[model samples]
Target: MDMKKYRSTMKRILGCISRYQWGVAASLACAFVTVILTLYVPILTGRAIDCIAGAGAVDFPRMWKILKQIGIITAITAASQWLMSHINHWVTYRVVKDIRTQAFNKLEILPLKYIDSHSHGDMINRIIADIDQFSDGLLMGFTQLFTGVLTILGTLVFMFSMNPAITIVVVLVTPVSLFAAGFIARRTYRMFKMQSQTRGELTSLVEEMLGNQKVVKAFRHEADAQEQFENINEELRIWSLKATFFSSITNPATRFVNSLVYASVGIAGAIASINGLLSVGQLASFLSYANQYTKPFNEISGVVTELQNALASAARVFELIDAKPQVPEDPDAAVLNNARGEVSLEHVYFSYNPEVPLIEDMNLKVLPGQRIAIVGPTGCGKSTVINLLMRFYDVTCGSIQVDGTDVRHMTRQSLRTNYGMVLQETWLKSGTIRENIAYGNPEASEEEIILAAKEAHAHGFIRRMPQGYDTVISEDGGNLSQGQKQLLCIARVMLCLPPMLILDEATSSIDTRTEIKIQKAFSKMMEGRTSFIVAHRLSTIREADVILVMRDGHIIEQGTHESLIFQNGFYAQLYNSQFAV
Candidate 1:
């Protein structure tokens, strides 16, 4: 990531941490106390050594007091470490939870196009794998990092108090070790970044394969799918291997440097002891402090590696959080109240991609309570109109108005609340049948839910099920037929009772008989409501108040179904083709 982006991400993470500042402060304080106790061990060992060397003349009472102090310090250190661990755990968990909740809430506000441009698997990976990686760093890496610094500082102060010459020798090696660690960490971070990206791709591939297992089996494309997956898997393996290899080298290399420094300190201390430059007890204490100093160097190196990995994950997460939604709402947008369902498209032009306009300067009007049928070839932007109407995407140019109010000036939530939609692909959450029906309005009463189900002709089938309206559905309603799933979606939309409804090929997957039944239910639901229907079956649109025949993003013919057939244009040809089949 660029420096500016990295700084921004750090700011956001720090903001998250600041909310739990009290927990963080407590954890840090405990760590400092633990480090203080750790530093006292060398002092206790030194005094015990002196008492032993002094033979019978040594102060037994002083020795006893030193031992007692050591025992007390050890107990306190254990308690402090325990408290620090728990505090760090609680803080990290809460921070991660808040981040996840914010990400989900932002997702709800983001436009559909933002979701469409991103892979579901990758998004899910950010929420799961990325967040998990961050929590590990926050809980373990941050605690160790702070404690290591405290230990190093405490050891240095005590060592200098004993002898500045020996302290200087130990401090001289610090910068070299730190520089080496920084270099290794930078390289390791690059590898970790690549690893996280590859992992996301791998996740996406695996998710796609599992979600389409049935299609893969039917088409006998198992080998092909496996080959594709192997490519992504191989990339992930390479990245992981590289990251592990580099990260592993850091610890061993730091250990080697530390060993060299310890050897030097041992040689220097031996000379100092022989020359009477240091007491035997002081020499032992100096050596202990040397060991303590080198240990944090090793810890620092390890933490650097961990911090790098976390930074990589954080970068990925921040990318999602920082991304601008495809369609942004105006800051001064107004809330649209109780719409009358009259909609007008004044010279409207739109496209998923601006380079290719799907609807060009198309003007149309639908009076309140009118039922309009839209028919066209597969790529004629039939669904795109629904997308634009719902503001899932904004028009590239021109304007769309609802109830004489410009949609662009209205809050997206309020604008969308005025309409109900039944997509071609129905998605039902894992819940009871009644729960699914009331999904549009969670506060809806049980009676209202049943009434909507009855209107959509879904009540009969639901009643026949083992649990009737209480029958629990699986995710995506796998237990129900396509027609039944469509009916459930219809019932969901009906319960909302929006002023406008859009049914985009909602019955296309059903059989002819089921289609007729669903059409009847839809007819009842659409009464006195502005409705837009997009269907391939001409028979389904014949009763529409107005029929619009679109091709190549333009309305080539439009009129009542009978008038269009009488005109013998594109609409007439479409009718003849469907009836002939």
Candidate 2:
């Protein structure tokens, strides 16, 4: 890990902790008391030892009194430790909650392009798994880190007061443990970071496979998927082992140095006792102080290992929280209200990638209440046009307007609320059928919801459900057939009944008879509303007032269906191919 980055992450971690200033102060005070009381016990023990002047000459009352004091101090120390532990938990979890909330909110405002380009599973891992890891590391830091440092400092002060020469021996030999831990920590951080990244990749792969299980099975790609999973799993395992190996050595290596320090203190103290520089009881106390001083090194080494994992996870989560959001909506933008839907694209240009131009210098105009149909082969910018019209992706150049007002000057919420959309891919949240239909207009009356469902030809199946319209659907309408799910989506749009409409293969999943019925219903609903229909089936758009035949992101032909057929152009060829038999 870069030392600079490590410091930066630590600073951010501290900044998060700074929010609960009172909690931190309370925890520190408890830790200070616990360490101070704990260190004082050894001094009382030394005095108790001195009171036992030989076997029979023991000062029984004095020994008993000292023992009582020791017992009282121990009880208080335990209570302080307990309070500190709880405080640490309170602060650590609150910080985790704040960071996780921030990360989630960032996702909400992120541009669709970022979400489209990244793996869903990886994003979920950063929000969930990485944050959990960070919390664990933070808990450990709050629990042991402060206490361990104080214990070390307190022990050194007590030891130096007892004997300066022995204190120097401990202080001199301590650098070896510090050096060992630091060396291991530096190498382990990079290994742990790689391990975290691999884990995210594995999660993404699993999520993709699970979500498309039907397609995977249809193609019999199970073995290939297993192979890919195994490859990523094996990579995660390797990195985990390497990180664990390096971190695991830290404890034993430090313990070995600590043991050597203990021995050196013992030998030096014994010589001083013999030379009449210290008493036997004082020597015992010095040895106790030496043990106390070195024990923190063992705890701190473990903390170092955990801290590396935590810091690695923190970096990943922070990356997500710090991602740039979509460009801010203008505060003073116009609010499109009851739009007349005179939509137009004026010299528009767009591409998913700047290097690979898809649409360029495109223009079109639609009068209010006109039913315009857009037909094109796949990858011909049909959907891209819809995306720009809805401001899901802004035009790379030029302007799109509604009711003669530049869309860039309109508030997104008001602009989107003016249009009702039904697409080939239907999405329904887990909820009752009534709730799903009312999703766009939550305040819609029950009668209104049922009327919309009936218009979409979905009321029959919805009434047959166990709870009628109140029947709850599983995620993405998993319990419903594809055609049934599409109807519910249509019903949702019908309930909204915006001034403008967009139907992109809206009836593709329904049977022909049902499609015809819904198409008639749609015709009535769109009687005086401007509507854009994108269809591959040429027969469905025959009644469209105008047909825009697009190819390679450019409009190659434009006319009514009859006129296009008379011209015998690309639209005629596309229409004829469907009825070739």
Q: Highest lDDT: which candidate?
A: 2
Where does candidate 1 clash, by residue pair? none
- Candidate 1 lDDT (Cα, whole model)? 0.86
| Model 1: per-residue Cα lDDT over 1-581, one tens digit each | 45676577678888999999999899889989999889988889888778877656787888898899899999999999999998988898999999888777778866787899898888888878988888887766767888999998999899888888877888887777887787787788778888988888888888988877888999999999899889989988998999899888888788887887788788888988899888787888888888888898888788878777787888888778776865666899888877888999999888878787679989899999999999999899898899889988888889999988889889988988888999998989999998888887999998999889887878889999998988999888988998899899989998998889998988877778777878887888888999999998888888899988899889888899889989998888888997684
What are the per-residue Cα lDDT tens digits for candidate 2 across 416-518? Answer: 9999999999999998999899999999999999999999999999999999988999989989999999999999998999999999999999999999999
| lDDT for residue 199 in candidate 1, whole number 0-100 | 88
Error of 1 at 579 (Å): 1.8
Clash pairs, candidate 2, are none
Instruction: Per model, state how many residue pairs clash.
Output: 0, 0
Best by TM-score: 2
lDDT of each: 0.86, 0.93
TM-score of each: 0.96, 0.97
